[model samples]
Target: MREIDRLEDELSPLPESITRIRKLISTLELCHHKAERWVTNIIEAIGEGDTAKGLGTRTAGELHPAERDWRDACVALSAWCAGQPAASVEIKIGGRSASCLLSKLGERSALKEWQVQRLIERIREFIGWPRSMHHGDSVYVFMEECGADFEPPGDAECPEHYREHEEFWKQTMQTRIHDTVNGEAADFSLAVAIDVMFPCNWNFVGNLDIVLGAIGGELYAAQPLTVCARNICHVPIRERMQTVCRTLQCSLQNQRSENDVDSTLLELLGDVTAPQRWLVASLDKTIRLQLRL
Candidate 1:
């Protein structure tokens, strides 16, 4: 009885220690993800000519000082984890307890949150940008600026169908959509028409490119005269729509429901302004007719 009591006393502390270890693991995982996102954003910003200095000239082999600091921290943490015992088991009066052991897990040698934040701050400074409160803020700003260049030139020459829906285009530029779905995070500008037409939770729309491409294809079809203005006269509207639909279908094949897709199309057909409603209805009807055929 005494031995059992001693074993129970020893085992009581094990659960708390394991809980602490699990929490540490989760924190480290988040930090790793944050670091990776920062690195990708910096690389993208450099590629887009957003950086003020020649710091963007560095090759992949030549990482910025901030990136090097992050990499070193990761290496040190990995080494420390590798050196620790995989697991430990002990027989005590309370029976047997198994514990996955980690050495120096939260020690000074490990990558700390403050260290990661400091590195990010330094990177922001190097790029002549202020530190953003949100980790994703810098990336979002870069994307928004770059997306402006994606607007097709010569809008003035577009047909009445395309020209009349100027508000839709403006809404697209104004709306800043952000969401995480199927383990992927997407942030982009979306047209207000789309925001209304989307049937399910707008947050579940993971990929904006697919949605935009689908809508653009429809818009292109509605005003065939705009083809000459947009310099896409060579491509048939049906072909373009098919290509967009195929890509969208493939992307959402596994991630989303058919009902969601159908409902969005239905919503597009149902409620909208005159010219835009006509555009959406045409596309929706064409797609359904094609499916039947």
Candidate 2:
């Protein structure tokens, strides 16, 4: 069976609530890392003092004493981000613990109190904290214990496209990559469909899948160890950007059938009737396909 079709089949029998819960958990994990980093930066800034302005380049020996100190702090931060792994982020709220290892690089450790406090504040701002916090252990566990929350917008129900989805996002991306390498017709247009839907702030339906596809394509196309400056500044951003851009273009050009990719994307504009699990699954598949390929 086609991998995508297999995924669809596997998801076809699963309950929606279970799928949604799993997806929610995955998202919360991502949020936790984001919160951790934001807090780390704020704490570092405070420690250096006068860091209201962000890190700026300065010649080695050409800064006021305070500026020098700030610069040194900034340098240390760069090193940490480069060196630290994503999984290493840990959030301890009272007695709860939440952590993820996506970007794990070197060691595992907690930050200073000031840093942790700032991270907590950023996280609170991120989820709108206490207000958005659900009362049950499910919500609290993912947050206070897990350290983040990536729940879908509560006001709207999850869409139809995601109805029967299963498998984690990372796995799905790998699968999509494999399909791409195997020369399947779906990968190309799907990638384009995603980029078309979701630009930086462009939140179209099923955008997450497109982003994963683009990432997969880029990673495959680029030289090993290409750096993503905006996402991760340790390496060359241009190469990474180029890879994603190329994937976007490739996806756009390769429609699965006679229909144009743009037209396919537009069909859902007024139609909010589709299952959201499908969208989520598609994205997960796209990402996994890319990595595997």
lDDT of each: 0.30, 0.28
lDDT of 1 by residue, 215-235 (tens): 323222111111111112222
* Stretches of model 1 off by over 4 angstroms after superposition: 1-19, 30-293
1-293: candidate 2 lDDT, tens digit per residue: 26546655766774554344334323321112132232223323222322332223345445343223222322332334445433444532122221221121123233222122222332333233244534342131111111112112223332243223312221222322222222322232221222122111112111222232233332232211111111122222223333332332333334233332223232222222123333333433433332332
Model 1 clash pairs are 7-93, 7-94
- Which candidate has the top score in lDDT? 1
- lDDT value, candidate 2, whole model: 0.28
